[model samples]
Each structure stands twice: as C-alpha cells, then as structure tokens.
Target: MENNRVKKQPPKKNLWKPEEDLILKKYVEAHGEGNWATVSQKSGLKRGGKSCRLRWKNYLRPNIKRGRMSQEEEDLIIRMHKLLGNRWSLIAGRLPGRTDNEVKNYWNTHLNKISPLGKRKHVDSNDQNNTNSTETTNKKSKIHTYPVISIDAQKNPTKESNGKKEEGSTSLLNPLMTDTKSFSYDTESPFIATNTSTFFFDDEPLITYMDSFALFEGFGYTTGENYAELGMQLVSP
Candidate 1:
C-alpha cells in the first residue's frame, strides 16, 4: 500500500473589518477574555475562534505596548532569546503586553538580520551538524523531550539526473534524500532529514533555531563582568 501524506496548507487570511473589531473589542471588554469559542459564536463574527482570540489579543486588547520596540525590550529579547531559542511564548512572557506572535514577527523582521544566526550558508553536509541533535527542555523540574534529529549521511551527496527515480523508489519527489534518510517528528516541529549537500529545509526555521540553542547547565546569560542569574528574570512589576 502506497501511503501519500497530505501537506497542510495554511488558512487564507481574511482581513478584519472595523465593525468586526469593534464588536470583538466590546465583547471582550464586557466579558473579560477567555472561552474564545464562545466569543466567536456569541459575537456572530464569521471568523475562527483562533482568529478572534489573536485579533483581540494582538490588536483589540487594551494596554498593548505598540509602536517602536524600546531599547530595553530589544535587549531583553536578545538576552532571553539566547537563553531560550525560538520559544517565542517563553521569551514574550518576560515582556509585558507583547504576544509571542509579535515577538516572533519582530525577530524575523528586524533582529534576525543583525544576529549571527541570520547569516546565510550554503546547505551542505556541514549543516548536518545543526540538524543532528536532540533538544531537551527543562523548565521548573519537569523534563520535556523533543524529537531526536538522527541523520546518517556523509559530506558528499549523490545527485539525480533528469529528476528520474527508480521504479521501486519512494513517493517523495525530493532528490535530496538519496541515501538513508528518515525525518519524522511527533511534535509540532516539522523536520525533514536530508543530505544537506544537495538541499535542505530553510535554515532559519530548523537549522539556525535549533543549532543556535546554546544553553549552559541552567537558564541565565553571562558576560565577563556580570553574570545575570535566572532568579532575577520575570520579576513582577
């Protein structure tokens, strides 16, 4: 049996109207925020609950710090990002009124260009170093296990001519997986194992984010003069 996997396409973005925003804002104001499904239903807005929640939280929500991220916020984001890579919600938790989406967008737009990980490199066997590690997240005391990216391939990759595959070859059209390659993950992170010499996924999402995660024994940032400990972080205002 040939099993064909369907790729999930992102939902089409529908712009929110002024009236819709007004209704969502008023409803949230009157009833506090929670139960997004109820808000989507009771508000009579033809939008998904996720959409309604994001709209309210990102735009309609009160006390959202907007217009120009402060120097302090940028520094905090950088420090926090160093401690926690691509975990936007955890990074945003340190910043008041800043949602994960907003933080991610800002990083992708502005900070990414300036950071070391932003530098583009040719997708080759060397990139395999970045993709070949299992991530472990330890928050509080509980240990969360991430998918182990296990790929066994040499520096040199085999090339395919005329884009032709053998009759008994796999269904996946990607020629990058010429050798033994299997990329599967149960978690949300969509990783594909490939011989990096020929091709690979975008470095920003999987390669840099995963490879850039350089953590010590615990959470905190350090410099020659000052070592800021984790106890001082997320201090309530």
Candidate 2:
C-alpha cells in the first residue's frame, strides 16, 4: 500500500522593492508612519501591514544614522542585548531611530563577530547551561550597566530657570484681592441674607435694586419688546 500524505508548501516571500521603499519613505516623510494598511494602499504597494511597517522602520525614513556604531552606542547595545536577550523591540527602544530588525541584524552580523575578540575568561551562560537551566541562568547572568538617558535627562539645561520664572508668575505664593464693585467677593450676599431672613418672597418676581439699576443705566440688558424672550430663545438647553 502507498502513502498519500502531502507536505505543506512554504508561504511566498514579501520582498521589499526599491520603488516601494522610495514611495514609503516619501509618504512617511510627508505623513509619518504607523498606519501601514492605509499607507500601502495609498502608495500602491502590494506589501502587507507587517511588511510595510518593517520596511519603513528598518530600511526607510531619514536620519536613520546607520553604519559603524560609536563606543557609547555600542556599549548601550551590548548592555541592552544582554538585559533584553534578543528582544529586538526592547533593545531598539534603548537606541533611538534604530529598528529591532536593524539591531538584530547588527547583533547577528557585527556584535557576534566582535564578542569573541573581547571575550573574557568567564564562560557564557548561554553556551554552558542545559536547556532547562538556560533561561534562568541567562536571566541572572546578564546585567544592565549603563543608566538609560531619557527625555527629562536631555531636556533644556536652563529648564530650572524657566520653571522658576513660570512658578513665580503664578499666584501660588502671593494671593490676589478681588474688588467688590464690578466683581462680588462676599461669602454671603445681602440679597441671599434678605431672601433667607424674610419669610415674604414676592410672587411677582422681585428684581434686585442693583439688577434694576443696571438695566436702567444700560449696563445690563436694555428693556425691549422681546429682548429677554429673544435672549432666552438664543441660549441652549
């Protein structure tokens, strides 16, 4: 008897084209990345979401700042790689503008090559540990050496002076006194006390002397045929 089981075929590669990369770079330069599906459709590229995103992040976008790494940058990469352990996304965050794929490719191509040159006498836990102990050993062995620089760290050196000036400008230290003529500062108004003290509340809607005076003096709404009614209609619910 013959067997009829079939082997599964591999998926087709989503190769990045030069023109596609150029279009992605241009569009991203104009409108920043992240909306990959919409971007691909707009750019007329046949690439999928993941592929388009990877292409733009890893290859395109200006100020990429690739090539030979500085000693400080390299040190950060080494420390991050050890701490994060092949977590390209996490490691890439430590180095601005650098992609996970770029970091991974650099680690595989460059770092691995140079790692042997500066190899210490100590055994690499990754190589020495058994499969079960590997994860635990690797976790404890790798240590982060550098202090991660942040936005606050790299903020304006004169920020303290600016902040001090800003704090001084606010009424935090010195309190303000409000005038009572145009503005009222009373905790209990005379009108409020008069209303609560007297049991007689006018059924004809008693207008305050100040309010009537304000209307008479044209400081408030002028008496008209339908000014109040018109005003009421204009106000939203």
Candidate 3:
C-alpha cells in the first residue's frame, strides 16, 4: 500500500517589469477589468493576480494622482479620517484620482502629525505646566539694578554758575553747550545723544546724556506698579 500527501504551493511573488506592465495594461484595456484570477496565465506575466491587480490599481491607473498631495487633499483626508476612522477605501472613493492603498499609506505616514482627532489633552496640560514653571522662575530671579538719572536743563550754565567760570575763558561754560542741536530734545524720540566737548568746566571734561521722557533704562511701561514707582517734576520759566 502506498500513501501520499500533496503540499499546497504559496502564491507567486516575482517582481514585475516594464514589458510585463505593458503586456498587463494592454490585456486589461482589451479584455476590461474585474477578473484578476486568470491575469497571470492569460496575460503571460510571471506575477500573481493579486500583485498585478495591486500594481495596476495603485500605481499604473491612468487617472491616479502622481505628485505630492495638495493642501485641499490633505484637509479632506483628515476630515474623512475623523469621520470614517481608517476606512481608506471609502475615503479614497470620495476623493477623485486617489486610490485606497495611496490614501492608506499617506494616513499611516503623514496624517498623524496634523490630525485633530484622537489627540490627547495631556500635551496641552504639559505645555501649560512648563509655561507656569518658567513664569515662576522668572519672577523669583527678577532684580532691580536700573541706573538712576536726574535732569535739570538750565539753558545758560554761566548764570547759575555751578562750576568756576574764569573771565575771558576760551572754552568755558558761558554758553554751556555749543551744539544745542546735538542735545536734539524731542518728546517723540526715545533718547538723544549730545556732544558735550564744548566745555572743560574748571579744567574737567563733562559728558551729558538725556532722555527726559523716561531717562532711566529698563523702565518698561509694562505694569501699573512700575508706573507708580516713576516720578518727574516740571520746571517753570
């Protein structure tokens, strides 16, 4: 007595070539689609029916989109994904010139970063926590090291006579400043740089800086508390 068992063969998975593609395309065009079983035997291709179907449907389709997905397409995919929940075939059917596999692949690789659906709330919470921590740290590390300045713009320093003014002095504080325009006072400008080399008051060089509007640096008008700390006096003519 002789007993025998037959082993089932696995499906063909040979890579498709250009000539094979041409042959398959022509055959499909001639005979029409929807019959993948006899594609290998009838069309003389070494690839299995499943492989032929995939190649034609996914890549070789005439109306398929070839370039990168447009913003409109991406938005649509996201919307559809939210509604349909990974039903790629249904989603692809809604979009013109797009295939199921292409949509599936795009969603798997690209859609996760942008999709609003299935997003966790913990991410936002973590961001808020970090922001609060940063704010607290900044408040703790704050310092008040701003420079103090006093402004008293006397037109003629010789009359006030704070410094010694010798008679017939070549470069004296008689007129105080030669380049009055260098002082360039304007309420609109932040600060004015002045050339104070016009005098050596009692044989000492004097440099002047004035931004009387807010003469102090780091005096940002950010808070009501900061505004309250500021003071100024108006001079009468």
Candidate 4:
C-alpha cells in the first residue's frame, strides 16, 4: 500500500498583521489549534490555520524567550545536545521559556558559527579534555563560568542526619562536568561525582549544610573535625 501524507508549508508572504494576530491568538486560546481548517474558517485569517499555529508556536507564545543565546547558553545547548541527541523537547525542558524550535534553529544557525572549522562534532563524541574549539576565546571564557547544578545525592555527602535533601537546595557554582570517558559514582557528597576533576562549593554554607546532612546518618558531630569520619563512613563501601 502507498501512503500519501502531504507536508505542510508556511505561506510565502508570512507577514502577520496586528488584527490577524489578535484573531488567531483569540481563536487558538478559545478552542486550541488541532483542526486547522476549522481554525481558518472560524478565526477568519487569510492564511491556513496551520500557518497560524506555526506563527503562534514559533513566535507569539507568551513564554517564548526571544533573543540570541548568550555564549554560555550556546555552550549549554551544545553540551545537552550531546547527551540528548535530537530530543529538542527534552532539551527545551532544561531551558525554561525557550521553545524546541528556537533551540533547533539556534542550534542549526549559530552552531556553524561556533564550529567554523568545518566538522560538526557529534555532541556524544566531544572530548571534555579538549576545551579548544572553533569558538572564540571570549565565548570559551563564558563557558568556563556557567554553573552546573545537579541533584544527585550520592556524589555529595551530607553530614546532617537527614537522608535526603530537598530540591532547590543547591547553588549553581560551576558548569556541570561531562566527559567522553565513563566514570563510576563513589562518594558521600551529594553534589560531587567520584571522577570529578574539580569541586566548587559556596564556602559559607557547605560546612553547615553538610553538617545538617550528617544528622541523617544517626551521627551527632559536635565539631567540624568529625566530618572526615562521617565522609569516610559515607563512602566506605
């Protein structure tokens, strides 16, 4: 059996007037955009409902975060794409207020600018040790400062007696570490993986915060010196 599914295309002259925008926005909000034919008929736009839907999604959504991605953001998308492949929707989740289309377009456009050396390195194959790329030195400096926050409880050992820390408790101190070489997790620090080459922490809170975690282990540490013992027990196995 032959299957025929025609691809939809945006109109050649895709100029959107204020009145048309209002009508489409109103209709989409009132009834949503599933049946495009009905949307065109009811919304009274000169263009197809699919066009309206595309415009609304690709541009007019209230949550859409417009503007060129900062260098750090560009690096993040590159890094995440390596981990997620073409799963733009999943990548979009990490970047609030940005659509998958925006990420996709940005990835397509700016990616070439970042990698002018002519090869599109598969994100998965990129070596973490090789920080040098086609990107400018200024952009590279921005990437070095981007914060990587994770919720994994194993890497960061808490000295507090509580077994689990709530979400939103960690601060973004540095870019999240990734590498082509796989590594195992062996630690008591909920924030640090065993093979991590560098550790960044907020000096003011880490001691007290880790102490609070010690309470979870049925330990009563009366002094800061005891944290080593707690850390040893937490990572003993």
Candidate 5:
C-alpha cells in the first residue's frame, strides 16, 4: 500500500432501462432464445447473461397469469403447501403460469398465518376442552360394574402323554360373559358396517367411515400387530 499501487475497482452493475429491455427482447425474438452469454453480447446490453435471463423469465415471459389468485388457485396452494412445505419452485411447477417468486411472496403475505398447522392447533384446543367437559360428566355419572369371567387354561389344561402342558394351551376369554363380539377369520362376519364406499387399498376412508358410527365409543385402531388386539369399550350413550 505504501508503494502507491492503485487497486482495481469492480465494474458498476448495469441499471436496466426500457431501451435495454427492448434490445434484449429483439435479440431473443431474432434468435429464438439459446446461449444467454451470446445473447447478452449480441443484444449490446451492459447487464450479465443471468440477469437478462432472470428479468425476461420472471417479468417479460408471455402468457403469465397475472393479478389476484382465484379461490381454486388459493385452495390448490394451501394443499400443495401441506404436501410440499415452502418448496416454492416445486409448488410453482404444479401451478401453471405462476412463478416461484410469486408463490413465495403470496405464502409470506397471506397463507402463513392461517396455515393447516394453525388450524390443527385450534382443533386440538377445542378437543381438549371437550375432553375436560366429558371427564367432569363421567365423574358425576354413576359407574356400573360388569362381571369379568376369566377362563384359565391351567384349570383344564391340555397336556401331552408325558404330563407336559401342550403348546396350544393358551387362556381364552369366554365370549358369552363379555359384551364384546368375536369374529373368526374363517367366517365372513362383518366387524364394521358402512354405507359409504371405500377403496380396499386406502385405510383412511374405511377408518373415517367407521369413526362416524356411535356404537363403538372411545376406541382407536392402529396399524400392524397392534390392530389385531383392538379393544372396544361398551359405552352406553
């Protein structure tokens, strides 16, 4: 620095003007859009190729659906947000004539506050209140006791000729004593009945349909091995 060596200054960024835009558009129209660096050089614009390309794509692109989003578009954006979550590029890809920048801006301005996560919190709070009320009611109500008949396998245990207990000697609950209905896998007895049609592969529709039935109260079903041991509480409403 003491030797008086002058430092090289960076070139100033080109401030885009209407004339430059016209030149870029004219060049693109003539060549039908290929090689942006070549286009920038040929267009005689001071801006870089990337900057020109971005300006053209985001602003000057033809058939871009501008103005306020429709109700259908808003609903689609909400659903896509739930599935994709802030992946604006991917979301924009699904929405025709919409840009990632537009989607991101819209989400930031509007959808962030009334998102599904916020709605879920409201629903959960309401459910908690309902549960508290139900608990209070249950505490005040008279509790009725039911007899539990436990059929022990050891009482009349199945044994081999050597006096060892057989492998199949497992305790079973007496069907007559309990309020619950037992369905055999071999039989075609319907455990759940619904008028609504449900796809065989999709469990959601079937579960939703069954949830409407008031016969089974305070019971939940899980997937895999836990599903086999579904407990039904006989609650008289």
Candidate 6:
C-alpha cells in the first residue's frame, strides 16, 4: 500500500548549453525584454519562461557589475537595508548596475554576518525567556558567553622624530600602517583581524555596558543613590 501511494518524481531540468545561451541572448537582444513565454517557446530551449527571464535579468543584463562590491556600494546596501529591510528589488534600484539577486546574495553571505542591527535583533530574540526558575536554569546552563573587545586603530600613529622606521616595531601599532582599519574580538577564540577601519562589539557584556551608560546619561544621575538603584535593578531577581 505504501509503495503504491508513493509518487513518481519529475525529470531533472536540462542543463543549458553555450549555444542555448547564445540563442536566448540573441533572441532578447533582437526582440528586447518581455514576452519570455514566447522567447522560451521560440528559442527551442527546454527551460521555462521564468528561468529564461531570471537568466536574462540576473546574468545577461548589460553593464551588470560582477566583481566584489566597492566600499561605497556596501555602505549604500547597508543603509538601504536598514531603510527597506529585505526588499531586494527596491534596494537594487538604488544601486546602479547591480541586480536584485546580487544584492540579496551579498547581504546573505557577507553583510548579515557583520551587521550590528542584525546581531542585536538576533540577541534580543534569543534573550526573551520565561522567568521561571527551571526555565531560567535550563537557559542559563545552555548559554555560552564569551568576551568580546572592539579596538579602533588611531588614524595617525605617532611618528619618529628622525622619520626612520623604529627597530623591532610591528605594523599592528605602527602609525604609518595604511592597510588595517579596525578589528573586533568576539566569542570565537583567536580573532582574525581584517583590512577594514570600522569595528563592532556584539558581546553581551558590551551591550549591557552600553545600556547602563545610556540609562545613566538619560537619567542625569550624579548621586550614589542612582548608581545603587541602577545596580540593584541590574542584579535583581
């Protein structure tokens, strides 16, 4: 009975060849975009209209930027992401020569990992928990916290009076070092530094510290009483 109920699977999609690609490209070039259904039928390709449309828009489109995104493009993507969320098509419109699929892929592969807002949302979602003793105990036992540090390299390192490289000086602290920008130490051990200039701190300790500082600043509390109250709230059961 189980074997009889099993459904037959569909055949695999045909792998597009260079000649098929050329035919599709020439068809679109001669006729111009749209009418993909007709193009698919007339081009003699086994792929569907949607597939042809995506191939043309994402790969065959003229002036499409194919390399790694520039700093400016990355910044724009970050800002646009914040404003528009995951509306990739809308975001792609703001970035000239970039396709929606490219922007979406970049965000998923790269930006999402480094995005502070994304991390904060993830942390907040995970932080929401019941206050029951058993639940709290289970959550706390499972939680693995690690130290995170953010280090900002001074834009200009102090130079030697003699204008000569100091003996035994490394580039990590060298003022003249032009490549490294900023770096972060995270939950992962042995943090690897990069050639960027901005650093982000995503650890719970840093977030707690920032929250406390903000609360203190907002309340304009200069007295020990306020500090005591704040400390109590932070440690309260």
| Candidate 1 to truth, TM | 0.52
What is the C-alpha lDDT profile of model 5 across 27-70, one tens digit per residue?
77788665887777777887788888876776666757788877
For model 4, residues 164-230, the per-residue Cα lDDT tens digits are 4322223211122342111122222322212232222222243333322323222233232443332
| Tens digit per residue, CA lDDT, model 3, 32-65 | 7768889989988887889889988987768778
Tens-place lDDT per residue, model 2, 11-110, is: 5765776788888888888887678878868878877778888777677766576877667566666654543355556556445566777887777677
Best by TM-score: 1
True-vs-predicted CA distance for residue 131, candidate 6, Å? 22
Runs in model 5 deviating more than 4 A are 1-15, 116-237
TM-score of 2: 0.42
Candidate 1: C-alpha lDDT: 0.51
Candidate 6 is scored at a TM of: 0.45
Backbone clashes in candidate 4 total: 24
- Candidate 3 stretches greater than 4 Å from native: 1-14, 115-237
Q: What is the lDDT of candidate 6?
A: 0.51
| Candidate 3, residue 27: lDDT | 86
Reference-based TM-score of each model: 0.52, 0.42, 0.43, 0.43, 0.42, 0.45
Task: Evaluate model 3: give its TM-score.
Answer: 0.43
| Reference-based TM-score, model 5 | 0.42
Q: Order of all candidates by TM-score, from best down to worst?
A: 1, 6, 4, 3, 2, 5
Give Cα-based local distance difference scores for all models: 0.51, 0.44, 0.48, 0.48, 0.46, 0.51
Off by over 4 Å in 4: 1-12, 116-237
Comparing 1 and 2 by lDDT, which wins? 1
Candidate that beats the other on lDDT, 2 or 5, i.e. the better one? 5
Q: Candidate 5: global Cα-lDDT?
A: 0.46
Better of 2 and 5 by TM-score: 2
Query: Backbone collision count in every prediction?
Result: 0, 0, 0, 24, 0, 2
lDDT of 6 by residue, 95-147 (tens): 65778999998987788767444342233435454221111234343332322
